[model samples]
Target chain A: MTSSDALAGHTFEELSDYLDRDRTPADPSIEGSPECQTALNGMQRLRSVHRDLLLKDAQRESEREDSWVSSILQHISLEARAGRDIPISHSSPTARLSVTEGAVRGILRAAGDSVPNIIVGRCHLDGDVTEPGAPITVRVDATVLEGEIIASLADQLREALYAALRQHTELAVEAIDITIRDLYQPFVPPAKASSDE
Target chain B: MSDAPSPDPVSTDPGTSSTLPDRLDKVVLAVPGVDELYSAAPLVAAVVKTVIATTVEAVTGEQKSNSSVSVDEKKAGLEIAVKIGVNAPYTAIDVSRRVHDAITDQLEQNGNPDVAEIAVSVARID
Candidate 1:
């Protein structure tokens, strides 16, 4: 893609750096661009939870695969754009209300992340999200922390996603399909492991 | 007192008060669920405008108000557009509707006649 297409003309690296700086000196270019702002929001959420997710594995940082993080970052960049305007009906003829597709995806990610032991990797809206009352199926890719029952976690995530979507938009949601792509085990202390064994 | 009555003093100058767009911005942010206000203008246009404004401010020492809310005067009425982020636990759609109603109320209170449309979109839901 050309220069203009990259996260509202700012690279993901630049965004990460900006966040690293705690958004000090307030760069108007990034702040003014909605796409950059959206991505930044996602990045901030991920960063906030990163420590908690890895607290048990602090000593095994090197063993953690960077691929999942890359995958989620890629998805964030793609989904942080204003793709389509899904209308919100208002009784007044003059009032036109709606939510952006990018915003919907943000909620999906948040909902999935809310579930314990699950991190949303990528999200997709499979159907005409722009069309009102269209049959839409939400497909989400996730990575779950090992030791949690996969089936139970998936069910909990599905319910959370459904609730978030129903609350935020008027889309006719047919189903929520969740895929657990990877499972990573947290580092357990030797003493704890021996005691459990 | 003199027999001649003093003419009615002007209560307040509309020009001195905050502009309609500014007022609407405040109103939207004041809504319980709104977390952020994003530029409603398209990305390309917003970038160009920011560049120009930044340059102009640096050279001329004059600050320009870069309001996220877009207002247009039309034959039918005024058209207002805005994009906002809704804080969690507050439904995005509900927040958007509240913002829409808030804008309409602001215009009505200001004695502005008719609203062509008020498009409020939730750009981010935290």
Candidate 2:
């Protein structure tokens, strides 16, 4: 295959798609070409940026929200699976109410976030979420704002999270355990502003 | 075809109601960690409205629809939904919960019942 011909038909985007699917139905000509292999390598490197999962980490070092945060948010799922149905008191025996695991997770996140300077990270409901009244553990990792008292923040987060869960969900939470994952730096004014004339 | 009045451009903010939507709008916008509130309009109109609202708010201390409210004539209630852009430092769910509580409180305080449902969509994180 000529150097240009190797990548002529399939765009880099197409080849990346092909690579993602294990290059199924491989075209012999592209596979055999050194030039094609080089282009594929370049495409792989580009994909690695997203693969790295450049999360927001809520860095407010600027006026606008960071561009990376917007990108990450676009890919996040809002309709996370709601767990099995938990029954509610209905006059009609057939009437039932249920909340999903996703909904429960939403509650947990909300509760944790309610606490000042606390942003919840990964949240897990670590037991049989499907079984009603089953004792399930809630575990979450959170980031705290720098300079905040850790003990006080934890206490506040615990209280808010508990209240939110109680008000919203029927889950018999066995325990809510929060692990402090990271501390974010507070926004600092520019040196130009701070400099005494 | 079911006979239905082309429901007045029933925005969550119809702007017809004097205090309820206006009061709720004030309370929602007042919440901390709330970066933005949503409005409905064509691209050009929304932009124009935003410009005007921001300008007026600066001078009059009265804000326009960051959120809106509408009533369903058939149903015995009103449904309110608004898109909010909030801080990433806080959780969207928490912000929504806060906003929900505030709106509910205002609606009840105003003696308005049939506030059937309120949905706070996190349109962006700032």
Candidate 3:
């Protein structure tokens, strides 16, 4: 490609390399004028716009109210409550416990309660608990469980499942399996301290 | 005790009345992240409050309000906050960072800090 056209794709450093090596066209045409310095200016403008967009995005993120988180949790909980039953195939197992991703998220949210930065991942029930007398094992993947929070989450899940089971049927929970999949990093808001003049 | 007569001070200075508010508006508008400069009424009132407070403090040499700034992101795009008595020196950077941080914190806390653009303004006491 021609030098000017090549510049459109190449960064300032690359273009500088071409100029330093005298590979740029020697013609005095406006397209190839040495007096017309344009590459870095365009890059600077582009960089400014990118940074502005980031700042704007950050501002938008900080201004959202609590309702958003609440709504997301509510939606997940609703989905979990309406658990679907996947058909048991062949002779592998007769009991089936199928839960939607939404329900799992909801259960996790319920378990998390007011805990911040808690995220739920893959969830599976180990044992068959679909029948009235069958024992069940609930396996959950979670992040951001520290110290007693894990135990607290487990307790919260037990209560949630117990209530859910009581409402749906009379199946008793044999064991609650909680696997700590991930940990969440707590986000701290920037401090606005007044600088003394 | 010369209590015979007191000349009435000029209460109608057109230049002061006309230019002061416009200057205040310009100063407020000059602060970065201030979008739709005309649409900020509550913020304008807050600025006026700050200006008056600052002026009173300057006259009496007494601290009237704390130097802290409070941000409230309600209806003005994504993030919004008000700085009552911002100190000098790092006024520009402080205001900019405070607005940015307020918006960022609120969005991060609420779980969607990457969707919208936020605007902020500062209100300084006189």
Candidate 4:
């Protein structure tokens, strides 16, 4: 560091971690620092948002259709947006076999998310998704739960995606490129063995 | 008209006005090609639906639908606006028409007539 990087030699996470250890007897260093105060405020906002989400989850879970309700509204909205029309083999001019880029994206995202402990950070259908019979590449940056081997997890995700595409879409999936963006651990992972192998 | 406080139009009594958004939220959510709800705030729910739900979806990025549903009670009728995220390959006009029908039919079923107009805004394609 630079002055912009830290508040008197402490990062935001450091300040937050310090408070996390104890919230009752406030730490003088953090309380006295403006940057720490700002970080605390940010954490407070995040906590409130998290609480709100839990409440919403409760409401949604109480009714089985609450999740469906979310999907339907999103479907309607997505069906209306403009993008390249991925063609499917349709005989009639009036009849169209086309999927929206957004729809493809949504499908890919869902598939990625379907894998246990997988969350997609970024997704793209690289290549003209609208072109039927054209080889298309799907790229996704994803985060996986820690302690799981990355290669195995990625392979599983890839298989799931390929299966979903085969079932739900007409696009020719040439490749699915998964980049492991981060390791997600709700808590810290155990340190690796100190073997020299 | 069966003036039973107009089915709690924009007030405390839980009836048509209170549940219209909830009804819309269900039906509209069932429509295909949806991604998220737009502009709905979190923790604000009905017995006073539309306003809170529609507004809050915009606030919290978590558990949001690509479509937003709003019901405004007016002297003329119920003014409804839905902001939606559409699938790029689909036609906005067709999808919006479907959304309009869904909202209208829902309102009518909830004992609400006199729908002033439904304004469908295409917020984005996600």
Candidate 5:
């Protein structure tokens, strides 16, 4: 498997297929590897957010560009690899504590997703993240649900991300730059809506 | 720092009760924010080890322990490594620290082997 498609030797397609199977008859290889698990978590969350829209989009494939979703998937795959080890300070000389870059990125996405009406896209941690006091800048792209004021939503997302980073990582966050990439309307499964009606 | 021989270095038998790596794995999982334990070794190495272990198990009818924690006995002291997944609402930073402390405390209980290093990394956050 090529590096772009795989995490820890398991391809992203394989991981997605595992999820599609509802993770039944669990694969030890995927379960044993942290990078694969990290990627799976990201893909699972993305699938959950896009479930209805995915169904709709599938039926109308040509109506809109699916590039955004593809971009997010690519980012998730890239970010899930165990990158640098961000050291955690400890008094004891023997204690070598750290949080992985993958884990930090995962939490950053989760924090951004926590803001209602927004789905976090690509997350980038700039600067020397391996260094404890380095000035790190968090740049993230997000898609806001239609109807919410973009400025307010961006502010909310930025704050949520900042708080999560502060709580989970000791990075010297210089700033959080949020880009409003697109707007998506919530898709209510037509079948469900018709049944309700 | 007791100059004791390394206690249960790479306990390969999962059936062996209370192996050092097994005990450490349990302790890490029990930590509040720890969602899952993953192999501290790199992915390719872990896969190869698993394959070899399975073959060994099939041939000898022995259930080899593939514990995620790695423990090494060094001239300096005991070296332990662990990777874990953190549950949301519980930050990875705090969870990793907790795991480190827990491992240290466990080792202390087991004759206080001088710890040269206890490397704990949070691999995922859910």
Candidate 6:
């Protein structure tokens, strides 16, 4: 069979074997020669470009400098201005339902998961500590949480906070309190936006 | 104008002190491609500022910072220049692309874009 015919329906390995073993057809022609060379070159170029694109994507992801913190803060401020009391709870000595900056941050970090583009704001937890298993409320100021994802975030934060508090201190892990104070629309700044646009 | 000692300016002046560097550090760290943003001497900052300024002008339609870059014979690699400009965008893609294009173009034009794998990052302003 001709080289092109032989290459047809053959995998790369088969082609490589045919080429490497010098197994040319009985009637040799330029088709057998340059065709193999061209195919091999194409494969190599494809691999190189594939690798470069992957690297470039990763590099682009890493070089990004947008801030989730500011977005979270903005959301929180907006919510506060709207007269909605952002939910928050602490299992400390004082058990109340107000937000604190630190608690807000803790909830956010826990909820962020591996998702990119999510930013958490400073948490404010109000409530009594020293009470184990107290129903601690939770709140978050985030830019991107939708549908069931918000519930998932709440669950994740509850678990994470319980574990973190227990792991770090001897405080009895009480109930988790969750409150989403503000939500922000994800924004990629104008300069970067223009490039992608 | 009545001189009131300027009230010694509240500590929150984004300018004045070393705030820009701190801010840049936060910004740079937030970005993905930036390994780190180091504070350099005045001379180094000047060179970096120039490089950045020239780069932005060449690549982006707008000029954001007055920074530049210079090679440190002693240090071997390029030294970062400073003259913090807060107006510069903090996003990594915006800064990196402009810097990358400028550096690449300059290097290619000068016959060496391949050799200078310089990564430019605008981490902080101070």
Query: Which of the two candidates, 2 or 6, achieves a greater DockQ against the reference?
Result: 2
Candidate 5 per-residue lDDT, tens place, A1-197, comes to 37655776677677878989998889888887777777887888878867776566556766757756666776887788888998888778888888888888888887776777888888888999888899999999998889989999999998998998888888899999999898877887555455555
Give the range where candidate 3 chain B is weakest over 10 consecutive residues by summed lDDT: B117-126
- Candidate 3 per-residue lDDT over residues A131-154, each given as its tens digit: 445676666555543444676765
- lDDT by residue for model 3 over B1-126, one digit each (tens)? 987543211121244432222332344445554322222233345445557768988999864542222322344333222322223322323443444444444444333423233333222110
Task: Report clashes for each candidate as comma-separated counts.
Answer: 0, 8, 19, 32, 0, 54
lDDT of all the models against the reference? 0.80, 0.53, 0.37, 0.54, 0.81, 0.36
Expressed as tens digits, the lDDT of each residue in A1-197 for candidate 4 is 23345543555456556656765576544443322343353344333433443345446566755342233222322322224656544332222334445445555555565676665545567787766778889887776667888898899989987875674467788899999876644443458998996
Candidate 2 lDDT score at position A108: 59
State the lDDT of candidate 2 residue by residue for B1-126, as single tens digits.
969543332333244544455556678888776666545232344446656778999999886653333223337466665545556456555666677677667765554466555655444333
| Candidate 1 runs further than 4 Å off | A1-5, A52-66, A188-197, B1-17, B47-64
Worst 10 residues of 6 chain B by lDDT: B80-89
Instruction: Find the candidate with the highest DockQ and give its number.
Output: 5
lDDT of 6 by residue, A1-197 (tens): 32334322344455445544555662122122222333343333323433443244335555645444323323332222111222222322211222222222322343343333333444443443334344444444443443337766656655655554442222333444555654434323334445555
Q: Specify the highest-TM-score model's number.
A: 5
Docking class of 1: medium
**Listed models, DockQ each:** 0.60, 0.02, 0.01, 0.06, 0.72, 0.01
In model 6, which runs have C-alpha deviations exceeding 4 angstroms? A1-118, A130-141, A146-148, A186-197, B1-126
Q: Name the regions of candidate 4 deviating beyond 4 angstroms.
A: A1-82, A188-197, B1-126
Candidate 5, after superposition: displacement of residue A195 in Å? Answer: 9.4
